[model samples]
Target chain A: MIVAKDVSLTYQDGTQALKDVNLRIKAGEIIYITGPSGSGKTSLLKLILGMEYPTEGHLRVMGQSMVKDEEDNIRKLRRKIGPVFQEFKLIRGRTAFENIVLGMRFLDFTPKEIIENSYMALERVGLKHKRDSLVDKLSWGESQRVAIARAIARKPSLILADEPTGNLDLDNALNIMDILTSLRDENTTVIITTHATHLIEDKEEGTFIRIQEGRLKMERRGVEAYE
Target chain B: MNKRAYNLAYFLKESKTLFKIDFLSNIFSIISIGLILFILSLVLLGWRVSSYVIQIVEREGEINVYYDLSLQEKDINYLMEDIEKIEGVSSTSLVSQDEAYNRMAEILGKEAGILELFDENPFTPFIEVKIHIEEVDSILDELESMLGIDYIRDNKNIIDRLQNILIILKVLGVLALVAIGVSTLIVVSHIIRQGIYNNRDQINTLELLGAPDIFIGFPFILEGVFLTLLGGVIAFILLKLVLGLGYSKFFTALPFLPLPAEESLLIPIGIFILLLSGLLGIIGSLFGLAKDNEKA
Candidate 1:
């Protein structure tokens, strides 16, 4: 779960990345953040990921305040959240299976759970056959799937995907969106940021928040959210 | 900690990958560290041998007493008896003319031909007195006060010089110890840092993936320890070979030298170097990780 109260973020170079953002995302909900290039969708994700701190106002992820001084606790908080980076961030020189398990090795899982989850995550993303393939040798689409598998394998409470459908063709983007949305389960919250608004336009169950310049406006389809 | 064991195979594989990434550089580092440790071992060997020799020499403190040969045999006997009666003197003996000549020839060995230029035996009868080294001064004073003793050749000057050499060797050993420690630490840590830099992307990925620093840095620690341990083994092997050669071939020429038994010397120093290298390996890796992670 994430809570943001009048949160604002301004970079050192005078770029207002977010301004007076107010929203509440609860556990077990699916949410979408859509905007144009440089529209602060990723910035909000970064804030939720604790990669950046708000210049003013308060923001908490999973009941923990996202502050620079709480770095160690922030790291512990990260363990509960799965993040699929825009660039994939799959480590090179490792197989797809290795990449998936790398995300779970430091968690509380046993050795058996680690292997099982890695196998199931790869199967879920339709990359089980390519598990042994090196990430560097994989195509861009395959790499993106590996990154998604890595994120989902951890079985995190919150899944934050930053432009998971970026650079993919229409079918692949739809596939990624399906795979990401299907990850939501009991006690899990899924938050996705993408500029491809068409992928979620027909989906009417989740809340939609639109951001422009530096402010966010939320439109709930059926779910009730925020204080 | 259980997680660490769970990832033990991965840690080893990652360390191997890191070493292979900079294979030639690591080999050079091992060789350089080995040579540094070898030099330190030599200084230690010199210190040990000198200390042992000085101890043995001190235990057998002796001085030569020369008197006028014109005295009758009975008077020489009296001189010997009087020397034995001195407070600190343990025992005394008179060296006859022929025995004194033979002793000189034995000492000179190959150089004894130089003494043949004399028409007859150039050596004269003298008293060989052995005393406790701590009582050397008192015994020498008593011998000097006795009559008909023309000269006393106490080994005080030689013993003092040997002690000075021992002190110098000890200083050199301590310096070598410090130098080996500092240089090995610097090289190992620098290499670990370099490996960290090379694998920064992997580290960053792991960090962002919620992996702990211990999880991320454990492979690097293993890599450093492995390399330095290898270096320690190499240093020990080279030292053993050198000492083996010393005892079997080189040192045979000077059989009277008081070098320590090879096993006694090698076993302890070998254990020390291996343990120190392993310990430094762990510390250096930690330093490298702390320094780089601080920047991040």
Candidate 2:
């Protein structure tokens, strides 16, 4: 769970990246965030990830103050949240399987368990065939799939994806969406950012929030409903 | 793998991984260090041997004194006592002219017949005085001022020239050490900095992961220690080889050569060199890693 109350971040040049933001994301709820470029979308994700602190007001993630100086607590919090960046952020020299297993290396997972769970996650993303392939050798869709496998491999409590399907075709986007939506069955919360309207139109796992000019504009829902 | 096996495997794997990255650079660093240290150690040992040899030669070629032929036994005895009282003389003995002629004859062996052509012994009734080597020049001058003595023969000029050569050698030794020390330090620092540059990304990742400072620095320190220790071992072997080669020429039968004594000092000296080399490595690494705080 993440809560931001009147959180504001200002750069040295007096530019406000995030201003007067108040939001709370509950456990096990998938939320889609749609926003334009420079709309504070990545800033919000960074705040929740504890990568940056708000200049003013309180920001809390998983019951710990985001501004606390305890580095151990921050690492522990990060271990619980798996994030997929727009660039994939995979270590280029490593194989796809190695990239997928990287998230679990710091979590005290046994090597055998990492291999097994990594394979299972790769199977879910239809990347099991490319497990041994180098990340640089993979196609864009395959690389995105590898990134998805890496995020889901460790069974983190919260999964954050920034433009998960931005560079993928429709079929690949649908495939990625299916893999992300499957997290709901495991009660894993998901937050995603995208401005690709066609990808999520009339297809929903939970709620949708839209933002423009660094501020949230509306919260809406599609035909899909929670039972 | 089982837990214990897995841990061992992981350690081996990581060590091998790091070794691949560091092995070639570390080897070149070690070899350069070893060659430099070996040459330095050889020079020091050579200088030490040469100094000891020079001291022995100077000791053998001591002052030989001559008195007037007319001086009697009583005069010779009085002169011996006077020479003994000289401040720098360690010991003195009176040699009658006849006795000196006889000794010279024995030295010349069959040529004594030619020396017998003289009606009388031409050798002087001298009091031969051996002075401490350090005070030879001053003592020679003092001996020359004696009123009744005809002449004093001391190899002070040769001794002074040898001493000058030794002084120059000592200066050269200091210069060599300083040059080698400076060059080795620069070479080691460059290698460590290259290592840091190569692993910069991994270091940043470790920092982001909240790794402790020691954990990040431990590997570099170990690298420095390993290279230095290897260099020291090579230098010790080289020193031993050099000593072995010249063992007979310099210290063959000299009782004061201290063969066993020197053997005892070898290990301690080798360890000291290794430790100093390791410290140099760390110094290089510290400078190399200083930039990380700013970049990270």
Candidate 3:
């Protein structure tokens, strides 16, 4: 669902976050981007989310060009992609149910569908018992799950999770990974970035990407391919 | 583009939460707006009353025309016909010396004993000419040129002063209206901006979730509208009470002034203020949203 050709990103402070990154991602594929801290893993997700534009090359997400002038189109594209921000970005003074359903309110879901899907997403993340709890009262792991529920509840075509496993114990982080991978189906593509490389070191399927010093290498497992 | 319909209850609930965030400040804003609008309503009431008084006075405009005592009854009849034919004159009728004396006694009320000191009636018979207020000067010129007319006495000074008062009241009313409009706009807009500032985090989250700008800003718009509408209702109540008391007092102490019926005046002005409040609420919210978006 994403195509990047010789993409490069430079910040206003002259920091080159990414250099000549080239990659192709198909629908329904589970991809994991593993790198150390400050290795441009989050920067790649930012480009995919249209939070930043490519400075030197072309990039397209879900058939919409990621460019400054295509703001409206990029906004529409965002509605089709569920993003789990590194910070979670859960709104305070709201219940977990409210936060989840708010993501689908402006989408094509009816009121009934919004409630049902919100509850279902909460159930999937194992937070149904805490659905009524305010996000501010929730623990760090609980907040992260609520953020993930908010993303998957919309049934987006693509899911991009930026550092979803940060500040979590091994069990909680693995549980988050399981929930994210389970969301991938015949029509959904899931791409997750994590600095904790051990989480996906034993994976048998899906695409594995490694980035170091602003350059990236790709390896595929199921297709027996390396790029 | 698949458009989704939002729940009205959801919007209202959101607005309620936003309002309660700073409940005391919002209550103060309502009181301030209501008091401002109340002042405007009082100005409008004064304008309406003074205009009505001017209208009644203009309609009753009359001048006294004195003629030579040597004229016979036929000559007086001819003079009356000629005065009625003038362009500005509405009608003419001769008042006898006895009738004038009786009018003066009625006006003097408890002081009519002053007229009994004279042996003969000192009042002279005259033709009372009713003319249009706007045509007073022309009519006076015509009356001065009439052959049998000895002198003409018109209340031009009183009429001119009344007209000047009407003009001043009109200008003051317009200035008060403009002041009310500008102050209300500024207050509502500032309140909306404050609401937006307080909810900036929620707004940013909504934006990242792909919510449309309209969806993100709808609750804030509702908040602004609700505050202004409350202000309007409070102003309406105060205006009604003041009008009731003012009308009763005027009827008791200044019965000569012509005032419109209470229901007719209050209903229209009440409706107008409420509608204006609603309109300003929407415009002010839009202005706040536009400024916030610019900053973003």
Candidate 4:
């Protein structure tokens, strides 16, 4: 769950990334955030991830305050979050399975659970067969899938994907979207940011928000979308 | 892993990876740390030896008082009885000139060859007094006032000199320990920082994945400890060999020198260095990790 009230973010160089943003996100809902390049999409994700703080206004994610001083607690709260970056931040020289397992190693999972969840996540991302391939050697799409697997392996309640479909062909991008959107199952909230507006036009369910400069331009709720 | 639990095997594997990442550089750090620690060991050995000599001097509580050679044998016997009558004197014995020369030869050991330069015995007879160390001041006071006294050789003077040497050795040992501590800390921390930079991406990824600082930093800590521990072992072995060689030579050159047994001296110092090395490694790694955190 996320709550933002009149949030504004200005960088050190005085670049206004977000302005007076207010939104409420519920658990177990799939959210599609569409925005153009440099439209503050990643900045919002960074705030939720505690990598940045809002210059004004208040924000909370999963009952943890998203402030500068609460960084340590925010980090603990992040354990319940699964984030997929635009660039898959998988460690080089490690196999896809190793990357997935590494992400779950520090979570509250037993050794057996770690192993089982990793294999299951890989299966879900349709990369179970590529589990042995080193991350550096994997193709872009396969690497992205491994990143998604790593994120989902720990069964976090919230999943935030920043441009998962970037720089990919239509087929691969759609495949990634399918995997990420499907990750929003029971008891999981999935928020994805992307510039690929054309792809979201086909989605029949889930909540959608469009960001134009630093402000939200529109909000659309399809069937079965949250209140 | 459970929320508060950690996998030791995983941490060790990560440590191995970190250590292997810059194996050549780590080897150099270990060698430098070892040599520094070896210097400290030598200073510590000097401290121990000087302290032991002082202890032996205090325990023997013995001094030699020379009498006028012009006095007749009857007068020397009366002087001995007078020394015995002193309140603090435990006992006294007359050491003959020949006996004094022979004792010097035995004390010199291999260096006794120097005494052969003399055609005649270059030694004097003296009254050896065994007094309680606590009663030494009163006894020396009494002997200095006695008649026919030529020169009184107080062992307390030697004890004072030995004490000075002990103080000097102690100061040197402390300085050496501080130097080794500071250098090892700097080297280990710098190396750990390099490791962090090399794996910054992975560290960032781990941080984002909600890994606790301990989980992220434990491998680095292990890496530092491994380097210093290796250094400590090297220092211990090299010190052992050097002490072995030095002890044999010292006994040959100055057989009367009081030294603690080799094992008693080495085992404690060996344990101390190894423990200190491990402790320094841990502190250094923590410092490195904390600095990185500040940067982030």
Candidate 5:
């Protein structure tokens, strides 16, 4: 649920990250943005996350503008986003369950719901056995699963996974991809950016967007492809 | 608000974790805050005791009126009635020469042997007029105009000195209160800032998760309040002990000083310190949070 029109982002040092990008993404659509390193994939994600404002043109995520003055509204918009960061950003000194539950603590969820959803997400990520383990003590793969569980526990309408398959074995990366893809439903859209294009080369559905040198090329599948 | 209520335990636990992040520093902060509050409590106690003494002295306002030595008993009786009827006078009574000599002997205590040098009772009988301190000038003027009154000896100098001491005590009390408030605020705010710095990673993660500022900052605020409250309790206990020990020694050493009962002074000062600690804790934490937010 994002819309961008002629959006261009240039950093303070005048390095242009994106140039005149225009795209429209509908709800409940899974998007795989495939690009090489420093190919504006993360920059696009940053724009969508409201971490940076566009230098030119307008961008909207979940009906809220990505502008400097609309920071409060953007924050509200972020509440509906489940972001799996590249580094997994799991808080140290906390158990996996605690980390997951913390994501939903400030949302509109009862204590019981938060705990239940946390457990359910942990089960989906195959981390239920490690739920009591401290995040810092967990292995890299285990910590990534916990981070995914934390993102999914909030039942966010939009999920953005940045480089989820980075540095993972094929089996673990496939499992992670399966968990992220299965989360998409009639009401939830998942957008994933990855440098590893081999993970989803033969997907029969969803949208595939390719970016290179601050430009975009989109390819759709299923009934949208026929249209 | 309801979500915050549900997560109350989480916030408190987070606060505990934050406090323990720098355990030694936090402990030191509590001790310093406690000692500062103890100093404030002592100043307040001094102010209270001094004010009590001044009040007792003011309420015992008196003037000694010496009459004509040749006045007969009936004339003296008439003069007493006239003095009692004065607008500001509470009561009047005659002190005989023997009673005056006895009073001096009691005042001199162990040095009463010097009075043996006198061949007769050297003291003169006078009318002791008790009047309201506020009406001193008017009462003295009235007495000076009366006939058969040879001299009026008022304890105005002592009363003035007592009032001056009370004024000084009040000024010192106010100064101490302001200084303590500022110092507590600074210490608490610095502690909160340090905690925020230590937990900056968690804070950043929460911020990216769309958590409200209140949710993210609540733990730091709780840590601040808990530390200050603990400090306040420590100060209260120390103050109670000091008061207990000081009261016993003061009554033994300077029993003539008018001191309020221990509870009368301790209860109110204890309550005030606790309240001030709580108030300063919240304000200082908020200030720290605001400044941190500005930096962010």
Candidate 6:
């Protein structure tokens, strides 16, 4: 769950990253935050991830205030949430398999259990054969799969993906969407931010909040009818 | 998640990865420390040998007390017994006038030929006194009372000067050891800090992964320790090899080098230095890490 009530952020260099905004998302909900460049999309994701604090108002994620006790609660909240970066952010030194299993290091899984779950996650992303391949050696599409596998490997309740399919072809992008939608079916919350207009066709009856110029546009009812 | 087990496994895995990533750097740091340790060990070996030689020479060069030729044989025997009763007189041998002349003749063989030229023995009767060298200073005033009556002569001034020189040499040796140790630490620390500067990103990543400070800092410390141990062992071996080859030729004349005891103590002393080097390495790495972390 997340709640941002009238939150605003301004950079030190006098740029308004996020305007005063009110937003809420319930547990087990898949939401898409769509906006143009500099529309505060990444800022909103960072605020939600507790990577940055709001300048004006409160922001809460998973029932913990993201601003006041960021250091203490960020790690705890992160344990239950998987964040996939736009650039993948996989460690260059680690192989695809090792990258996928990094999240599980904090968990007390046996070595065998770790191997099994990691293999399963890689298999889900169709990257099991490239398990031992280094991240530097991975093609863009293959690295994207590895990032997704890492995000979901620990069975985190919430997954925040920032342009998860940015570098992928249409077919690979659709497969990524299918994988995310499948996670939603299992009651895992998946939130993604992207400018890819084709995602509207596969909206799947969920909320689509669009923003422009640091302000939210009208919520369209064309996709999935909200309860 | 079980935090304890998780942290343990993470530390083990991270340390392993770190070692693999920067094996060459670690080796370089260790070798730098090792060279410093080797130099320090050489100084110690030299000091030990010097002191041992000084001690031997001092023991052999104690004061000689000559007896009055006018004293009767019974009186000279009583005087010898009285001198032996002194606290620092370890042993005193009574040398008759004839024995002194014989000793001088042996020394001045073929050169002076004074013993044959003189009609009577020119040497005075003397007591060959080898005092317990350490206690020689305290009993000097008591022995001076025997001047010109029971003893005709004494060489306390010469013994005093010799002891003073040995003391000065011992102090200089200790000062040299301290200087070498401090300099070794500085040089090793500088090398390790430079290595840390080169691979700072690796350290940052480990910190981000929630590694405890010791886990992050230990490799550099161990690097120092390994180098110190290796250098120390090599130094000990070198010292022994050199000493062994020259034991009979050079060191037999110099009794200051405690032959078996000091030789056996080398390993233990080297181990102590190895531990110290490791500690220095850790400190150096931590200092660099702290500065980098602050900048970050």
- By DockQ, the best candidate is 4
* Estimated TM-score for each candidate: 0.91, 0.65, 0.89, 0.93, 0.93, 0.76
Q: DockQ of every model listed? A: 0.49, 0.19, 0.45, 0.56, 0.54, 0.23
Runs in model 5 deviating more than 4 A are B1-5, B66-72, B96-125, B147-151
Across B211-280, the per-residue lDDT of candidate 4 in tens digits comes to 9999999999999999999999999999899878877875656667777888988998899889998999
Candidate 3 pairs with clashing backbones: none
Q: How do the residues B1-296 of candidate 5 rate in per-residue lDDT, one tens digit apiece? A: 36667689899999999898989999999999899999999888888887887788888889999999999999999999999888889999889999999988876766689899999888999989999989999988888899998998998888788778878888988998899889988998999999999889889888888998999988889998998888899999999999999888656555556678899999999999999888888988999899898988
TM-score of 2: 0.65
- From the highest TM-score down, the ranking of the candidates is 4, 5, 1, 3, 6, 2
Please tell me which model should have the higher TM-score, number 1 or number 4.
4
Q: What's the distance in Å from true for residue A134, model 3?
A: 1.5
TM-score on B-chain, cand. 5: 0.85
What RMSD does each model have against the real structure? 2.8, 7.5, 3.6, 2.3, 2.7, 5.8
Instruction: For residues B25-110, write the lDDT of model 1, one tens digit per residue.
Output: 99999998888888887888888888888888888799999997788889989989998888878898888889988887876666
Candidate 6, residues B1-296, lDDT tens digits: the string is: 45555546665565455545557765654565556656666555555555555565565646677666677788767877887888888777887778887776665545456567788777777777777767776656677776445543444565556556657666765775576566656655555466466557555433333334565566555554444555555555665565566765665545434454545546655666666565654555456556544665
Give the interface RMSD of candidate 5: 2.6
> Comparing 5 and 6 by TM-score, which wins?
5
Name the weakest run of 10 consecutive residues (lDDT summed) in model 1 chain A: A218-227
Q: For residues A1-227, could you state the per-residue lDDT of candidate 3 as single tens digits?
A: 89999999999999999999998998888999988898899999999988899998999988899999998788878899899999999989899999998898889887888889999999999999999999999999999999999999999999999999999999999999999988775368999999898999888888999999789999899652542
Model 5 chain B scores worst on lDDT over the 10 consecutive residues at B249-258
Q: Which ranges in model 3 have alpha carbons more than 4 Å from their true place?
A: A224-227, B1-6, B59-61, B64-78, B94-126, B132-134, B147-160
Q: Write the residue-wise lDDT of candidate 4 on A82-186 in tens digits.
A: 999998999997899989989988887888888999999999889889989889999988988999999889899999999998888999999889888877765
Model 3 chain B: weakest 10-residue lDDT segment is B1-10
Q: Local error of candidate 1 at A106, Å?
A: 1.6
Pairs that collide, model 5? none
lDDT of 5 by residue, A56-97 (tens): 999999889899999888887889999899999999999999
Q: In model 2, what lDDT does residue B1 have?
A: 62
lDDT of each: 0.88, 0.73, 0.87, 0.89, 0.90, 0.69
Q: How far does residue B63 in candidate 1 sit from its true spot (Å)?
A: 3.0
Tens-place lDDT per residue, model 3, B1-296, is: 12333556778999999899989999998898888887877777777766777777778889999999899999999999999999989999999999999988876666689999999999999999999888998888888888898888887886678778878888988998789878887888888888899999888778777788899888888988898888888989999998889877755454435667888778877887788788877887888788888888
Q: Model 4 residue B148 lDDT? A: 97
